[model samples]
Target chain A: MSTVAGSHFWGPVFALWQRDMIRFLRQKNRIIGALGAPLVFWVLIGSGVGPGFRLPGWPADMTYLAYFFPGTVVLILLFTAVFSTISVIEDRREGFLQGVLVAPVAPEAIVLGKLLGGTTLAVGQALLFCLAAPLAGVPLDAAVLARLLPALFVVGFALTGLGFLVAWPLESTQVFPAIMNVLIMPLWLLSGALFPAAADSWMRYAVAVNPVAYGTAAVRRAFYGDGASMGLVPGYGPALAVSVVFAAVMFALSVWMVRRRRGTV
Target chain B: MTVYPVETDRLRRVFGARVALDDVSFAVREGEVFGLLGPNGGGKTTLFRILSTMLAPSGGAARICSHDVEREAPAVRSCLGVVFQSPSLDPHLTVAENLRYGGNLYGLRGAPLEARMRETAEALRVADRWSERVKTLSGGLQRRVEIAKSLLPRPRVLLMDEPSTGLDPVARVDLWSIIGQLRAESAMTVVLTTHLMDEAARCDRAAILHQGKLLACDTPEALCGMIGADVLTLTGREPDRLAGRVQAEFGWAASVHDGAVRVEVPRAHEQVARIVEAFPGEILAVTAGRPTLEDVFVRLTGERLGEPFFEKAGGRRKRR
Candidate 1:
């Protein structure tokens, strides 16, 4: 059964994670692409709609950029997570992943390695995007940063795990971008990242069920502070608990998916 | 206890309706360079995949160092190092980093892991290329790095699939020399598949497979001896006609292979002159030499190894 065998479990996991980081560092275009799209979205869409767009609970003083700010951070994390996890398909095709598969390491370690790798890249990019918060008119305090960092980690881990689950069984990368469009974009859109869920009464239920909604709310609460107590966004306590549970569930699902399709793929 | 590094009893693998491997049993000793000589689709890869724990057998048992390949795959994997026919290196990483990652999978770290990696790189003569990315290295150097990666774990049995494929003649020779050195120094048991007869001739023992069946298994000398003492090759413009004439005139059974008339004889040197004389100007060239592994393969399979079997099947399928 090779039940991880103590300290050895971390070796391959850490090595694989390190490989992903090295590859990410060498490819500057990937960093630019992952962070650029959401930045463009925050600017173009936030300006296109104009600052006059407002919800009932939002501060009358708020601008569209401030409302779209936290959503852009989540988008950065999601896009980076998706981009990094897609390498699982590439690695399998390139034959490097096969080398790892045939090794004595457990499949759980392989999944953990991939999850950690993708999550780290996503969180790093998300943090970098958060540096532009002052431009969006959101105050960047130490307490807010502390809360935002862990929220980003939980959100990034869950999204990366989701990407891992999708990429593990896939042999080719041709259709993955379509999945990103159909599944990921919709999940992000319905999470109340771009607008208030109360704008559409039925969407509140959808937001309640959407796992990404909790992540979006968690980030929004970190940014909005006392003003985030409105009904539109879930409270920080419930949001963090849900995001943590979602991350844990996705992690387990990623491990299960890898174990189910280990040698077959 | 001296356990056989590999043992399979009637190991069977079926890919849907196609039986890739049928009831085949074999055993490999602790230390010897064994060759699995077969044409493509002859089930050599299926067996190799099973032994490497990449594929499970449909029926029967396969063990490595007495560990069940299916039930105890981790134990089997721990002791088995595999060099796939296709390149398995990450072209993005340097040779040293690749080796370090491979070692990490086996719980190898710290100074001991670094020392072992250095030793393997030195042994394979790839120490100088350690800092170079695998994409920058030549095919031969990449192959040596692959071997070094496998050696990092100090496995008892090394399984390679068509290890010499895509290598030049010089690289092939270099690879065989390393295999020989590994055998002499560490007594490492090597099992590799090769369609090249010259490569098979270097093995301590070789198993010939045809149509998913074991045709013959023995040392190179013994296998050649099964056919005859010598082989007479007659090259002519009309090899089929020359083969017919030789059969009728000399009463020797001659076969046409690869556009050449071939005949097995006890004393080929004495018959070479007679064949040229009998055929006159029809024979462009005549050569008599000791039987090679190719001749032995031809004797068993009645077809050359590595040649496309599909072409032959295409013709048959049209007629049907």
Candidate 2:
């Protein structure tokens, strides 16, 4: 009987994921916005900031554009992850969330299904942003691409989990956009997504505490062949470990928050 | 006889200082259409939400098919189907897809899920338009699809919240007919909430709720009988003065409320002459009719049925 119940759990998960994917495909404009915003940042902001700064600890002769490209990839993850929480609020208003909440599946599975669906869309956006890096004069190799996949997955999971955590307490969509502006922008700026982390010790300490900073570091390691330029502290191992742990913790918190809120309502 | 499909004991749900549901308890028998009749914010929706396992009660307990909602939520959820007041379908998906998703949630797959989908579509009269996107469908058709989705799992019990709110009159009749047929065929227990007296009259049994408390529970005929006599409503310029005169002269039970004068009259046609003779002002209109569920509700709560007290022009009943 337990085995039968376990088998039933995957049915709803697949259905939810498929439904989201189909919706994403149907809304071409949303897909474009998700993928296009990072490219604009790469061209407009990267050029404006490129000439004025030098990446710390990078080998000589490396272009500033090279340093900024990885940051742009992480930026895609940051923006998409934060905005995805709005979908949760939308779901709530539309009563779709209540439908799923009443399902027989565990709350954890429901959270996981939503996270996976949102992360898949974010990953697609991030990959589209990654494809433009070489055209902007950043070099890419097979080794880099190989490492980038896992890094992107970790980043996606972390951002999606964070989105779920933030969406839990929200009752309406009107408050979410304002909350995202207040929360995500500072996290992105402090995470070396636009500049090197070692510019100031205080800033470096702040980035060390930021979960997305680990994701940035991991992405930088995947893209540049060296992770030292991404942050003051080098090494993809610690960054990957931190991101994975953060994702797990946030995902658990999101599940618990949903359950707790369900109890109250 | 089969056991009760749904039973709750002193179910209470509190949000902060407000009590959404206050010690509410009721049971629904198999194959019976049970109505939770109440005005808006009267805890009918809250009770439905708790029974569907979407919201937990702060106190008391509920069971579906003998499975406790809190302890065995999974089993309860599986045993029951819910059609929320708000439309829950994805506007992006087709009718078929929506039904398929609902079926999948109940552990249905393969031929069984497909067969259920087909059966529900036919039963709901939406089989011809299964491929149409829900957004393109009319409100009535969309509601039919929602009903079809709820029926996909072949649940032992079905819970609906104001299912006819957005439906047209003809559509509502058709939907109720479908519900009656479905209950007759499957013997599934149905618990629905509505403020429509005509809809409530169709139910096998109904519980009238006002201010999060059960005012009365019984069949429609029994409820109307509790009011004793037919209702005689007289509207005129000086309703209060006229009501006082009528009450004094005839020594009849009469009350002036909600802009109308209600009198318990055995023979309303005969009483009309006495009323016209006793009152000084000209009567604008006089309505004599059989006491309905609305009268029963108004008699118990001292408020108009269906119209929420919170929405009255002046501050009326204080929120508990």
Candidate 3:
């Protein structure tokens, strides 16, 4: 099965990780665009729709701005971390990835490298959005931010893994915009990030099914504890559990996609 | 036993009903440049993929430096360096950054990696271009840097898949010169795949593959010697018709290949004038020369190596 033979694993992984970081840093426009669009959405939508956008069975005191803050964090994670995986398609097109495919390292090393790199970027951007937590009426502090870090990281990791899964076998990113619409956009929109999953609707089933819903719910729980529609998606403990499982499964699928053993790709 | 740098034992691969490779067996000796000479879809790519560990053979086995390409793939990969037809360098990264990452993947680091990169770049005549981004380098220069990057780990065998695919004539010449220099400077074995007959001639030994079958494998000189006669190629607008007429009139067997009629005969230079005169303006030009690797491949397969793939497919469909 081509299990990693030696200490050779980490070197290649680190090389890939460092290269992604370099690319992320070099493209300053990407930083502005990825973070800026989400921030603008949160400000415009949360401010314009304030107080009137309450679903049945929600906390009465929760304002739209506070309710959508974690959603904005997840949105930034989706754009910064998940979209960064499009580089895999670019790598294949540029012929850079074919070199790595033939390298001595196992394919798991590649999955880990890409996952860690994307997760780091996404989580970093999400954490930056945490500076706006006080605007959402959530008490922002060191302890709460600490809780937010791990949840944000787990959710970001899962999202990046999802990106890797899609990008692994693709030769070109020509259809990625279509995929962003059909797949990524739906995942976020239906994740109860915009609306409570616990409310009676046909999409509640979809929210219950989507792993990202639990991820969003977990992040929201970290933001406001038990008050912000905690039972709407699966509460904090069950939501975090699903997010962990989701991340693991996504990573496994990505590794299997490129492993030389089965040679399926 | 002297372990050959590359070896395949009855190697076979199949995609559904079509066998891409069939019972191919050969061993490339150490310190010599070996070539897998074949046309596109002639199983050269399938074989290259198997050896490079990008794909697995459905049956039989292949090895690199005595390690099984399938079972010991990681070990095999560690000792093997590969140059693909595509550029592996990141266009945004400078030549030096690319080399650094390339070496890091092989677990080479620090001063040793720097020394190796400089030494290999110097050997490849690309030492001065270290700071240039790969996208800024000419196609020829990028190929040199690609080779330099592969050599940083000092792999025992360097394998290339159609390394000259997109090069211009001058770049092709430059590539061969770099290959020759690499051979001269080190005992490392080099193996490359090529469909070009002239490129095959530059190899120490060439293996001719046609339609998933290994026709022959030997030194280029010895392969040419298999067809020990002068070859005359007659260019004309209608090679199929010309080949038929040459056989009907001259009573000498002639075949059509790549828009030319080819004939093998003793004293071909003398016969060329008589044939051209007999055909009168029908024959546009005639060139007589010693049999090349192309002639050897033609002799072994009875079909031209450069025949369009659709022609073979059409033949198959007709038979079906």
Candidate 4:
């Protein structure tokens, strides 16, 4: 019944993606919570740590503000992903998702549409953060923008897919916000974002196991360019590989969750 | 390979230890209005979910338009339109926006999608409310938009779950009229589940369900015919005692409905006088009329249907 090739897949995905983008642009509170709060945190934490902040293996010349800059970008992506995927719970309660579930689209189409929507919003917010990288001594040119945007997309897609996985089967926003805070908050703290993956401590193993940490390492590598080596995963290639794997796993899990419909939609 | 629009063979579903649907089986003819009729917790919802391809049967099979609902869901989906018990519109989006999104989800786009949207909206009578946000519309208006959304794909079978749950009296009348219009105009099989007896009465045929079992299936008139030609009701202080006395006095199986002794009689008007005359002072009031679908239900199962009736039917197929 489809006119264009692959429209059966892309059509629904586009509808869901456009829906989230329109909602994000129209709601000032969503934009503020996703973008504004992270910018404020970047300023406060980056300044509070000051030039006095230095790790053993890192350069003493690098200020903590420059050190925490990538963390702020990751934080922005997380907040926007959370903001966008919260609607999944709302959609379940409101019955919109049920309508989509009964449609002629595949489960992968539903997962992709929802994940891509959140990824779009999260990356959009993080792009706003990239404009201020110059304040933290990070250069901001077309080449930097080109490299940084895709890196933000990778981090955002992984985070948003994670959110969609958690949010799909949930019936309400009550426990979901708590899950984001209690469960995901720790993954962020260990993500090399705070203190360079803590060389020889128990935290080094914790950071090694966290999929989110690889994402932070990737954004760091992309933002700083060639030879930047203090990221938790060490190399850009390895970090990107791990982050891509995490993103794929999360996306796959969400699709499986949507398809496992023995009891409900 | 039966040529029915929809069919289920020995279908069953269990939620842990509780059986939501027993070995239920039925078939729907083309362009007919069929209803799954029962009270709350009667398993109609579970059956509706299976046929709509939203849930799998724990055992047996369901086919829609000759395609298996579970194994060939995508093929079945193209032939099906489903209206859920709950509202499915995005409140922030306008009616046109909701319909367009619905069309897109089914792979329709561009000029044909726009033409179909306009046609469906006009047919559902929501054309004037095209620009209004769904949240801003009245409940009845919102319901029209919902039906409009489902019809965009031109489905061959329309499955509705409690289609009139929240509608007011006037809106419900409009809703039934719309269903009637569709039946007269298109060759679409419409199946719905409802606890409302009047709604069941309106259907061309109905399947009476209770406690995961199919109690009876036939046209409403045929099902009602199971209760005699007329109903004879007598109310008094002691209804259970009166019911027993009725069975003894006349060989009719009398049932008590809401503290009234209800008996199905061949000639209710003739019997009502005979009953009052025989009972004398014990009969406070007497009334006679044709048996309704509710009367059929109460006769076959009993009102409030309580645990006593369920315990009896639990052991055997009540229809047999």
List model 1 lDDT by residue over A19-126, tens digit each: 999888877899989999998999999889885676676677778888889889999999999889999988987778767867888777888898899999999999
For each candidate, report its DockQ versus the true two-chain complex: 0.45, 0.52, 0.51, 0.55
Clashing pairs in 4: none
Q: Give the DockQ-based CAPRI class for model 3.
A: medium
CA displacement after TM-score superposition, residue A215 of candidate 3 (Å): 1.4
* Docking quality class, candidate 4: medium
lDDT values, one for every candidate: 0.85, 0.79, 0.85, 0.83
Off by over 4 Å in 4: A1-7, A229-233, A262-265, B245-251, B277-284, B304-320
True-contact fraction per candidate equals 0.47, 0.57, 0.60, 0.62
Predicted candidate 4 versus true structure: per-residue lDDT over B79-139, tens digit per residue? 8889988878888788988999999898888999999999999999999988888889988
Q: After superposing candidate 1, which stretches have Cα over 4 Å from the reference?
A: A1-7, A199-202, A225-227, B308-320
Winner of 3 and 4 under TM-score: 4
**Which candidate leads in DockQ?**
4
Candidate 4 deviation (Cα RMSD)? 3.9
Q: TM-score of model 1 relative to the true fold? A: 0.94
* Better TM-score candidate (1, 2): 1
Q: By DockQ, is 1 or 4 better?
A: 4
